[model samples]
Target: MKSSHILLLLSLASTGAAAFELGAPKNNNTDNLVWTGHLSPDTDSVTSALIAAHIYGGTAVVPEGINPESQFVLDYCQIAAPKPLNDFSQKAVGLVDFNQKTQLHPTIDESSIVAIVDHHAIGGAPVNMTQVTPIDIRAWGSAATILADRAESLDIDLPAHLACTTLAGILSDTVVFQSSTTTEYDRYYAKELAKEAGIVDLKAFGQKMLEAKSDLSHISAAEILTMDYKNFSYGGKKVGIGVAETLTAQQLLDRRNEFVAAMISYKETQKLDHLFFAVIDTKNKRANLLWIDDIDAAIAAKAFTGQPKQGWLVLDGVTSRKRQIGPAIQGAIEGKK
Candidate 1:
């Protein structure tokens, strides 16, 4: 390892993120560490788990089945997806992509978490983590960026498949750098990973990935809502947010009645105080927000600048749910008396 990179690791050690060690297992523990991501495994979540396990000596697992985009990436790279982990009881685990209790498996024990490498905000994470636990939580766009950075710093050359998949993870999470959540780290590592993956045109590769993601014709309305869904809490109000990106936004909008019915059922079944679904046009860089009813629409109106058009809240040039939609809804809910 280069001196600068070694110093970088030492710097991380001084901070709370000091659990990463290259070479053999810490204390010669022969037990295999299990790495996983959030509940609804997207491209970033699944790929980050795989990258984390490969870099840190563990097996990658997913809480549930992965999305089409993730599956497409894995298949395109000729890499096997992680096996499903129904229960994480008493297992030595590492988390990637998300660090929230709501996102974890119901059977996961807090003490079982050995490490966490994420790019989202820290909320309801395990507080009783061991002193030597590695907790690398940054504000980067994707967890893959952080793990790829570690591999680069340690001079650990990832195989071509992992490298390509890592690049796919970054592209998926950051929306190919179109999302506002993207950062310099994401961009830097994206170029490096693209080069290592032997991808000639990064944007072309991303478009192919999005093409796979947009092929949601066969999935049911409920499945489409939850495929990329996440639950959040704001000011004691339970909220569920769902986003669907497609090249043909009109096709998804054509099924508006079905989406509305599904949204109503989802909100009621989940007992959520607020629920909003956005159909993002990946090519046009816009979103059509879907709500269940008047009450849902009223609440959603407060969050986005979009106006209602043909029973959809049309957000022009708004392509990000995490940066544009989620936070806006959070602020709207929290600001409410």
Candidate 2:
């Protein structure tokens, strides 16, 4: 069968919109293309796929958000394009089955997946992974940027809805591209994607998204910790770091006491060798590091000089993980050796 005919059949299948069966590749691979990449399968990646599927006519099965205790069905299976699937409502899907543990399985049945894109450390590769085609995973700012790049490279015209979704994904994942993980590739691709989608004033849009997430009135300190929590092993010990960014140091400082207390509590509970909570003042390009272990203060003192100062260490030149924090931590760790 011709490739065009296959695509036409896929579009027609989208109209029926059945539940995604596991282990099936939705698109026929007469060409036997092996699209592969690392799949962490976070929100940005899932949402990016959803938008792309909408544009290309496919199903998107997205699980709930990070919260696992809440009783909600964040999972939604829907068709991506041609005026949205009628069976699925337009409301933003909430965390589905919050009680269910979320796991990233390497293979979804052939009937479910058309492509995969992600940005996290690669997990063990799977056998007979039929769903993900043209997988593109880079440990960078956002998978949305990767998807946008793919769409552009293929010369695939992006619909306005998909474009807006992609834009939002980039803003959220990159923290408006101010995150340490943000890369030049992310910025360049986002700019081009925004232009292609006819989105102007991306800066303002990013600000709006940041403001929306920054509202702390309803969020607790613990909630903030889990949003960007990561752990690493060093010197036969485990260290965990949580990062939060705010418009002003004072704004982050307002939560300083609570955040510090939370770090201590998390450290004891998780039994980590060390815990570091960093509040980044994006506007000033400064960072305030809150330490939960003895080495942290010493590490900061040697790395930055001066007294520990209220369990807080000020870093003037420190701004991002890739640019500043990662290097500082590496230096401190290496210095210990």
Candidate 3:
């Protein structure tokens, strides 16, 4: 065979032999590499998987929460790991470690990021393909479902403990698959993962997770603000914002005051060009946009005008930021003189 033909045949064979295995680590040559953090799903699952991978020879680091102020509780609240939570806590945990000064793309290059399965909208394009093993980011439901799907796809034997952790992440993100983001795939994976985790009743598991997240009695306004905070640049300016809403209209109504105060405080602290919060009534398909500092800027030349009554601007059929708020805000920013 010609040299070019030989190369082409080898390439074809490799492509044909490429199998789809979810949770298995790629490139098993572990000579100089120390760790691989499987970022996606909940911090707890990523932490658990990392610890396991570390046991065999590798360290693991997961992305911190939107605003990870508190110390990470690896095995707290019934989470499981290779070692006791106390032991994991005692050892120095690795962090993804991206700050304002550090360029986000190059940071992942320092270590072998084995797997990246995320549910959030991809923040920015990343560089470094040398060790880019597997990346799965689904906009539907939860990152947890993606992780579960990976385990199934790879035919990896998921332990009961990991299954429960995956189930909690799914329930938390999907709000028991009641959120508009939930899809058939999410439900399918949830059922499959629950079974693997030895959860007899997936619905009950979901309910319990929801209950645990809903226990907001102890959470302060600042904690709630940080929990869902995000920053994005638009119209030649950076905007820092936070979103807080209840799944039910009644819950939103009950916490209206707290949510309002939190938005105002967050706006002042962040010093953003424009600060806003959307109190989404998911069941009603409505959103109450709370304008903290820039009501005028938001509605300057736009069709919507006038101060929102009680800091609540009713938006019919506009609950999602990706579908509605993000586009609207971009348009407003672009249209500005």
What lDDT tens digits, residue by residue, belong to model 3 across residues 109-200?
Answer: 42333334445443322323333344455565655565555555555666666566666566655667666677777787778767876778
Per-model lDDT: 0.81, 0.51, 0.48
By lDDT, the candidates rank as: 1, 2, 3
Residue 289 lDDT in model 1? 90
- Quick one: best lDDT, which candidate? 1
Candidate 1 lDDT over 1-337, as tens digits, reads 2212221111222335334443333442326578899888899999998887777777899999989999999998999989998978767788888777767788777666766777776532333444455567777788898889878865688998999999999999989998878888888888988888899898899999999999999999989999998887777778888999888888898899999899889899889888999999988889899877776666786777777778888999888876678777877777742
lDDT of 1: 0.81
lDDT of 2: 0.51
Q: Please give each candidate's TM-score.
A: 0.89, 0.62, 0.64
- TM-score result, candidate 2: 0.62
* Tens digit of per-residue lDDT, candidate 2, span 158-183: 76656665666676667677776787
Assess the local accuracy of residue 93 in candidate 1 as a C-alpha lDDT between 0 and 100: 81
Q: Distance from true position, residue 142, model 2, in Å?
A: 3.1
For model 2, what is the alpha-carbon lDDT of residue 83?
25
